[model samples]
Target: MKTSISLNQENLSLIPSDVITPSYDRDKVTTSIVHIGVGNFHRSHEAFYTNELMERYGILDCGICGVGLLDYDRRIYNILKDQDGLYTLITKELDGSLTARVIGSIVEYIFAPENPIAVIEKMANPAIKIISLTITEGGYNLNEATGEFDFSNPVIVEDMKNPMSPKTVFGYLSQALKLRMQRGIPGCTIQSCDNIQGNGDVAKKALTEYIEKTEPELLPWIEENVSFPNSMVDRITPVTVAADIERLKTEFQVEDQWPVVCEPFKQWVIEDQFITGRPEWEKVGAQFVENVIPFENMKLRLLNAGHTVLGMLGALHGYKTIDEAAHDKDFQFFLKAFMNEEVTPTLGNLGNIDLNKYKKSLIDRFQNIYIKDLISRICLESSAKIPIFLLPTIKAQLQGKANITRATFIIAAWCKYNDGVDENGKSYAIEDALSNELIRAAALSHENPIRFLQIRSIFGDLIDNKTFVDAFLSSLKMIREKKIKECVAEINSRLS
Candidate 1:
């Protein structure tokens, strides 16, 4: 165990025999996909699948080349570069079992901010057929109210003025596609791995609108040639901490600089639309469907919405991790009711999906102790998440005139959580783009509970609904006056 070797191409042989490593020759693999925002989720989910295809099925032509746009991505770029684009992935199961694998799917990386031209050149390469993204929901730079690409954003403004020296993802894509057009190479597919509804369509809209405003001549060509396929990806990959790195070194004798720890579950349902071509990912457990809407809806509503519910209430109840909160009986009961009564009614028919079984699996996933998924991580960016994950169900329930007390409580808990203080009076930072605005609103809500609803961008027209208003106020008051468990019990009692 003391002879742990640093993870890299040269040290691959020193890695233990029990751990799975790439089977194909790394040098022979060529890059066909360029993934932006190469964070932990991409490592654990998309890159892992590609690695599977390469090792098991000899799919060497579709290797991934990671591109990092923002300054924060420098950390990832350094880690992957040091390791020769190799890292360990450890999947922790519910029953305390572990699976360790060294993934080498990312053959190369580009820190785009440092050298934008190189990134564009790589994208323009005829060999790279797909450009994918895991840039978070906020990264799309869309106006929430209008759902349009925000040209007024400072970055977009800068990109518009100097298109060749681009900064934003849309800018880079536009320039790269222009290069490809000039070189007479076929267009590549633009795949969005973000969690937004109709993510591919969103990516297409954002990129095309950027082109329309800055370079109108390229818009028509982009529209005709490029295809953006919607995809639904699911995996509970936690933020890798120091403990995870040490755990890999101690247990597996592998010193991965940026190892990712996740639960033993991953699902990717992609629309089968590729311009040049795509890997036979279906051979390695990926689902290629005509439409990805149903699967997207199922995962977003059941898993993501449930995470928000647990996150807000869990943070307020002094629970640090999702598994800790999910293990509590009251938390579990409230979550089930919220999903069945409020969320499920809003969902359309999920083809061949057993709703109850899916719900059960979500609970099991959340309660996986070995994963140590932090509640705070889920609670990050509540402003963006509330609108995307929780609001749709609330809107649907209101239209149907269904009981939405639990759904309303989800919002109320978020409001209270935004106050930057937990039930034990401990202060925590509100990690959100709108943290300042949300904190100011939360302070005002303490004096006038209606103030939080008036944030039109987040609440929209729902603020005027008397039923939702009353329910949210009532829940917020109960959470302020009583313990979270007591508030949950009171809400459940009303349901009974």
Candidate 2:
């Protein structure tokens, strides 16, 4: 667990021969994109692509200036600031090979809470074209019931009151855009790299709603100049554990405090609607298309939903990681059935993607033993993820009156998961934004199974549908009585 070299600009040469280091001149790299929410996914996907552009073709204009908005972001802020914004990205291929690369796309970083005005000024800079974001699914601050930006959020309200010293991403963006408009600067693109379906549209809705409440006059200029392009971003970047850091130090001889480890596979399907210029990401395997919804649905339903199926059942069964559950035949069969029977039919068209092959690839990705994607990580934000990834398939299946057995079982398992006790009676905390309410509702489900769905914020009107209620009640009963394994086997057999 000892390290020989610290990762920084000067130590690039001392990095191991096998690991790829950025060859571009860092001094010449210009910050054109200011990315918010600089997390593991952003490091692995967008920053990796941008770094490739700089490393492969010497395209330095698209260098990223990473920004962290939340209080928890202080860790990343300090790590990147200390490490000179350099971190090792270790990619584990399916064949059990590792590729280490030093991603240098993030040339500078700004922690917004330290100096809000400085962050706003950087975004207002004329050279900064795209103020990109990887804020998580719930980070948009949308009201779950109404499907609009939640202006009632405390931080948002604070941002509205004190615009210059903003609290949220929207506040900084609105203030920055106001500065740009005042100085006669052209409006830049506001791109979202989150996993949400129609991420750009969601971003536009949230930001525009914020502007409408604060500065209504900025709307017309934003409409004319700014572009919000929807995108589908995929990569299996697990949260860095203590083991990951030690591995980098022992095997790679690099002491990186906040290195990212992910699966080798990555895909980005973007709508070709950037108002300002974008990086030539297509040169590095990113697909720029006319519409990204089909692809988004394909990825979300198949990959994200599939992960939920595994995570929920896996947690109940005491399986620690995604690979553990994925390796189980029962879990694999259940997931494959859910994807083929429930999800695939709902996806209208995916351009050139073969649905069957995509499903198989997803199964393969889930079973990657090297990835170590934790069940806890997969289940972290279920309240936000389920609506976007899993619920639409359920809704579509209901409309078609198709088999909802597997999907129903997953939901049942989620309810049991929120009960805070696994099948073996071992207790674990529900790591969700709505954990308190979810736990209360789930606890009430013991008397009346419909109580869980009555949480209108999460379930919406799904509780009102008699057919869904019946199936959910049945599934929840089976989960409590028969447990996850037997329940999964029964569902798989029933679907088969």
Candidate 3:
């Protein structure tokens, strides 16, 4: 029987040699980026790339100093700190192979709830030239209908009152930039790693508006010095549960409190704009392009929208995980047809990307048995996700006069899923910013399907379009009358 070796800086040598440990000296690496929302996605994706750069090219200056803004982040902070800012990254391949490595790009972490000023001071340091974010889609606090920062949010309102001790991401960014300005430190690039389309522009608008309202004097300096470069980042990193941690310990004989488990696919397409220089991430598989918009549109429409469809419709069909749904032949056919027919038409011509191959890769990624990505995780924040990911494709299909049968079915599935009952009549929590409002509307829409489309924030002006309303109603009625799998089979047959 083998005993597990505790993972930490002191025990690096004791860990099994088969597991790839960091080659670069961790002490030699210096912080150059301050990343907010140091969740599993950041660790698995960005940090993994940075770690690879340090190992392969001896780029030690681009070390990451992670900042956790929310109180809940304290747990992750503690886990990473205990391991001396080192963690395990396990990639699960579709063929049932696993690659385990120790990533060491994050040299320090600050739990901002404990010392918000420390986070600000770190960001103000000229050494920290880039402030990246992965605060999720809802973290931006944008008005869904207007596509602008929502100042009416209680948190934003409170942040406006006390900008010195800020609560939200905007508040923290404002204070940090002010400190940097006072010190005459040049502005740093604000990189958004979130899933939102044109994420950098979204961040720019939100941060600029917040500063304009809170500190009018800082607006001119921000406009002159700051840069927000849009980026497209993709990776299927699931939330690490206890089972993942135990698996690392049991299988690999490495004791890790928090280990990130993800599929063996990662892509980051960034706009090549940085104020104070950045890591040569391209060497480590990051793409720096002149414009990330086309890549962004393709990924958001096909991959993200596809995930939403799987989440809503799969849950309705009583599938708990993505792999489970992908295993079902009907669900697989639904995904392929939806992508090939509905989504492909909306995407523009890519230079070299074979869209068909990309769709097939997405299917393979979804079917990775080792990645137990819960459908509920994808289903979370549907109110925010649908508007950003799925709605654009729907609007495009409508404008182009293309067949929207699959898109309409996805919306209907969402509406039905919002009712808080699964296919087996099991009541589950519907997690969303507008859960109550959605549930109320979903209840009414059972009789009048148009009532759900009247959600102006999510549906926008689509409710006024008769064609959209009719298709939505027809799909919703089919879903209500027939089983979810049966409804998918019917849609597939029609498309066939």
Distance from true location, Cα of 98 in model 2, Å: 1.5
State every prediction's TM-score relative to the real structure. Answer: 0.98, 0.97, 0.98
lDDT comparison, 1 vs 2, better candidate: 2
**Please, what are the lDDT tens digits per residue for candidate 1 over residues 1-496?**
2889899999899899989998789999999999999998999999999999999988799889999999898998999999999999999978897899999999999998899999999999999899999998988998877888888899989988888788899889999999999989999899998888899988988888878877788987887788999999999999888988888888888898889999988899999999788999999899999999888878887899899888988899889999998999998999999888888888888878788988999999999998888888999988888787888888888899988888888888888888888888988889998888889998999899989898898998998899999999998898878888899998888786
Cα lDDT of model 3 by residue, 257-317, tens digit: 8889989999999999997788999999999999999999999988898888888888998
In model 2, which residue pairs have backbone atoms overlapping below 3 Å?
none
Query: CA lDDT, every prediction?
Result: 0.90, 0.90, 0.89
Report RMSD for candidate 1.
Answer: 1.3
Give stretches of model 3 more than 4 Å off. none
Q: Residue-pair clashes per candidate, as listed?
A: 0, 0, 0
Model 1, position 58, has a per-residue lDDT of: 86
Clashing residue pairs found in predicted model 3: none
**Candidate 2 lDDT score at position 385:** 90
Considering every candidate listed, which one attains the maximal lDDT?
Answer: 2
